[model samples]
Target: MSIGETPARPRKKKKHTGRNIILSVVALIVIAGLVAGGYLWNLGRTFDSNSSKITDAFPAEETRPEVKEESKDAINILLLGTDTREVRSDETEEDEFATLPGGGRSDTMMLVHIPSDRKNVFVTSIMRDTWLDIPGVGTAKINRAFASGGVPKAVETLEGLFGIRINHVASIDFEGFKGMTDAVGGVTINNPIAFRPVHNKSYYFPEGEQKLNGEEALAFVRERKAFTGAGGSDYRRVKNQQLFVKAILGQILSKETLTSPAKIQGIVQEMAPYVAVDESLDATKVAGIASSMLNIRSSDMEFFTLPNNGPGRSADGQSIVIPDMDTIEKFGEALQRDTVDQFVASTDLSK
Candidate 1:
């Protein structure tokens, strides 16, 4: 070896470390893909097998609001929560739309809006006692629309009021709250106010963040009687419900839950039995919708109640919540224009 001749370079032994690392990563990715694919397939099957379907849930196209070009890709889903203890066996389908389960008296109503960008989800709660004109039934509480004409009438009334088209409807019995809460191994929520659920007085929820099991969650979301005065209005219940929603979404999306195939499967199976969606929202459609929103996180969800005057009484002396149409109309317009983010930013959501 001559010192000045760049010491006869020893031929470098071939290194396979980089290639081996690449191969190992590719193999792991393939295995993970297989596992995830199998898990999702099973989940879809379970969801389809247990869920119920509603036919022709929407009203006539002429009667509902027209979808604007900017809002064409946005999705609006109406979620109804009902306490259906009695089943009317003699009910008949009216105007092609089948009567919703629990005879169509919705206790909880929310309009879920997902914009075209899919960056955020907005949920606006509508009080059951809100006074609005029901189609074909004249003036009445909004909830009466559901009982009078089921899904079609309910959809018509809301579409007319907001001037925004509703794309889908999903009805869930109150019993679902328990099963879903338990399936997710119970949701942990921050409790702003403390109270006991009306049905179960023994379960007291204290203020601050706490974990609630199935029974406790049911009570927490359903305890309207515990609140009194201005704060006790349906606003409290809606707030609690919204909080539960955010908490459950966080839990379901957590790495611990998403990584566990059994937990994800259990959630779908348990929730499906109590849910009924419009015919178009089948398991495959649902999976597609979920896939599109893969980037969404719990923090991206925004919840607010439709603006309304505190409380009022109808002409007949029945108590009601008077909607602040002036403000809500602006919200609706934003929906049509697909500028809800700006509308939400400029407007006050304290109500």
Candidate 2:
């Protein structure tokens, strides 16, 4: 609801390690606030040179959407959590959560809409398994759009589908999630259901309000398969991911967290190293956005999934989500008209 909810810039990624994907969301909020608070310069000049940049990620003229902007206006960003395929043999110990699909797959994607007044933030969680067309490539799972073309391709794919202009893009790895989470001293969540986490059966949580440290939170979100009898609900996991992000934002928004420069810088330091952001998301951009959003509060936030009918087997037997086009178009229209509040109020959020 309040400012410091997420990084002001847009970001993207592959392979939805539910918790890791949300880390991108966390980084945008944490780092952007640091820049606004003057902690950025104190961190030194290495900040700019240190972060990896995604090349040619902006959409071309022909494919671009018409957007209106003032010095202060609404911003649409894509936060991506990716599974980078590089095999890091240098590390003495393996990061258990980092092990994922071979190709760079944005395991999780979130499109955040920040209104002009910045009173409230509306978020849409995109299910990776949703069947859709990729620009230059044919129809496939939406997550695969990033595999070969990287950030640019993924941005184009979303632009094509949503018909909205993306102002910034940030991509982060799984390891960054844990580091950032721990830096904030862990998060407390109202666990909706209790089950064994997907990757590690050893870690289990009861259905109740609980506090989870970095590692436990990561496993908490990844547990889609254990909750339901049929097992593995991508949509269900997405809800968990959304709640986790909101909870983290709430943690940072408190007076104690915001006043503490060390905690903010610590998150930025741990998160910045693993983030790959588009050219538009510099300290200047982050600071400009954060300064205007200092009044935001947790109650001003809203979360929902994208519209999809149900799941079906592809021709080749691959499982995929069936998107509801009529519903998607209306949502896109709301984004373009800057009437997200009305749209969210009138329609049902994706299940």
Candidate 3:
């Protein structure tokens, strides 16, 4: 046979190589499973078993004594920051400066609303000194509700004051706040003025964007006198708090911080332990809430203190914040409908 003819003698049948195809199929399946697992895990953690009980406190017209699908969608959470300087279980002697039971007060109170649609989250900070009705306790300082009966009383006070249903409550102690700030490395704030803290004598930051560590961040938020200038007071301080929150949020949502697993884990661990959620919430659930809020940009979140005419002495002789009822009612109406524009319009900064 000719050499060419012999070579052409049927090339040995090439066996179909299925190995690569099989490996590819296996890889796809594994990826799909991981994606599905992650989704399920997140969903399962979004709402805890006791969600109903905790949410029952806030009664929507449609949700009260009845079941409604729409009512389930909108959620309002009360964020309370207590001053527990003296109530430490490990402490033998009460520090004169401790705020909790013996000395401390509620330094900050914020109401966070996460709409059912998950479009954006709205946060409103209530000045701790705002005197309002405390349900069964009658009228009193808002911060005292925590000391009188812990979170339950505080929730009652908020429900009475705002006439809105607060679905959940989350309390984070001071140490947790510090740790969270540290975990995120630090937060940046725009300091338009410079001053010093009366209590700590720490140097205040100048007007500009400043990176703040845990301690400095805490001081910044709590520094009323410095931010208010000669007339520095809680009103200005609350505004600054709102600004600080926005800055912290900006830092947190930045690509550099959110994408880093190690940093994220550190933040989660440090924050989770110090947080006390209503019986309904846990770390996983809170994480889901945070995830849902990822879409709310720093600019989208607007902050305003309750409009007040001035500080006045109550019949009991104690100082009290006199809220502009007309404006406050309008703000409440806006909150009920989840409209930021209405709320912002009702606020006249000129006061």
Tell me the whole-model lDDT of each prediction, alpha carbons only.
0.82, 0.74, 0.64
Compose the digit string of candidate 1's lDDT tens values, residues 1-351.
466666333343124556778889999999988887787788888888898887789998889877899999999999987655443353223211223674544668899999999999999998877888898999887777876777899899988988889989999877787888898889999999988766567999999999989888877876787888964647898898889988988899888887787788788888898898999898788888898998898989899988888788888887788889899899989999888889889989887
Q: Which scores better on TM-score, 1 or 3?
A: 1
User: What is the C-alpha lDDT profile of model 2 across 189-300, one tens digit per residue?
Assistant: 9987777765577798888999888888777665566656321467678888898888888888878788888898777787777777787787677767776888987778
Predicted model with the maximum TM-score: 1
Q: Candidate 3 versus the native: TM-score?
A: 0.74
Ranking by TM-score: 1, 2, 3
Superposition TM-score, candidate 1 onto the true structure: 0.87
Q: What is the C-alpha RMSD of each candidate to the true structure, in Å?
A: 5.9, 14.9, 7.9
User: Residue 91 error for model 1, in Å?
Assistant: 23
Q: TM-score of every model?
A: 0.87, 0.80, 0.74
